[model samples]
Target: MCGGHSRGHFGHHLPMGIPVSVPVEERRSSPVDVLNERLARGEITIEEYQRMRSVLDDQYRTKHSPHIRKPTTA
Candidate 1:
């Protein structure tokens, strides 16, 4: 069991033959949104949320910033 829900219970709701099409934006939430939700739910403290948000922001910056170049392998 996961999250107090049985695997079979989850499988029961899924359509076997039908293909489900959900937009990418609808299917996914940003990390910051998830963190905020957790904070609102009292799953994480404000301190934890701020720390994690900082880490996520740093990772995003490192990933998207062109000024930081990856070393080329010969």
Candidate 2:
């Protein structure tokens, strides 16, 4: 008899599962952090920050909040 027979569907080795790889650029800079850094570095003025934040909010709603997106939407 086959004593060391493996179990489960061919590739289902780990019951807890494994992680999928993701791109680096897609995983950087949270909204608040981006705004804060820009503000701190004077890259954006207070008013501009506020305005960008509003747009960013809309972006966060539509997209997955990946830090940047196409400005002109059809």
Candidate 3:
């Protein structure tokens, strides 16, 4: 049993058999959060974390800022 539920029942069905619905934000971890977790777990070095974080930040800004246009391929 896990989390007080039988192994077979764990995460399978609710009391009325209704499927669990999670919000989009709750369902997925943000890229930055994942990166931070990786850093905390020693999976990435500080330098790598900084470089990847910068890339993620740039992508977020480019996607959210209307004034910033993406480069077009010829």
Candidate 4:
């Protein structure tokens, strides 16, 4: 009974299927646009906007090149 159960479980262990394509929706607003809007509405200070923009820029760059670090020598 144990052997039969093991054989049943091990059958067809390899995955079989064609990959399905999924559509990804693009963001409606760019990071720059979102930051500008927040600044215009007084929701963020100039310093906050600058910081957020820098952070977002770094994030975008890192996303595109995760293995590469930003230059620190200046």
Candidate number with greatest lDDT: 3
Ranking by TM-score: 3, 1, 4, 2
lDDT by residue for model 1 over 1-74, one digit each (tens)? 56677786645566789767778777888899899989999999999999999999878988899698656899
Q: Which residue pairs show collisions in model 3?
A: none
- lDDT tens digits, residues 5-69, model 2? 56644545535667655697777879878898999999999999999998878877668856665
TM-score of each: 0.54, 0.42, 0.55, 0.51
Determine which window of 10 residues in candidate 4 has minimal summed lDDT. 18-27
Pick by TM-score: 1 or 3, better one: 3
Model 2: which ten-residue window has the lowest total lDDT? 1-10
Quantify all predictions' global Cα lDDT against the true fold.
Answer: 0.84, 0.76, 0.87, 0.81
The ten-residue window of minimal lDDT in model 1 covers 6-15
TM-score, candidate number 1? 0.54
TM-score of 3: 0.55
Task: Give a tens-digit lDDT track for model 3, residues 1-74.
Answer: 55687777655655786778788767888899899999999999999999999999889988899698767899
Instruction: State candidate 4's TM-score.
Output: 0.51
Put the candidates in lDDT order, highest first.
Answer: 3, 1, 4, 2
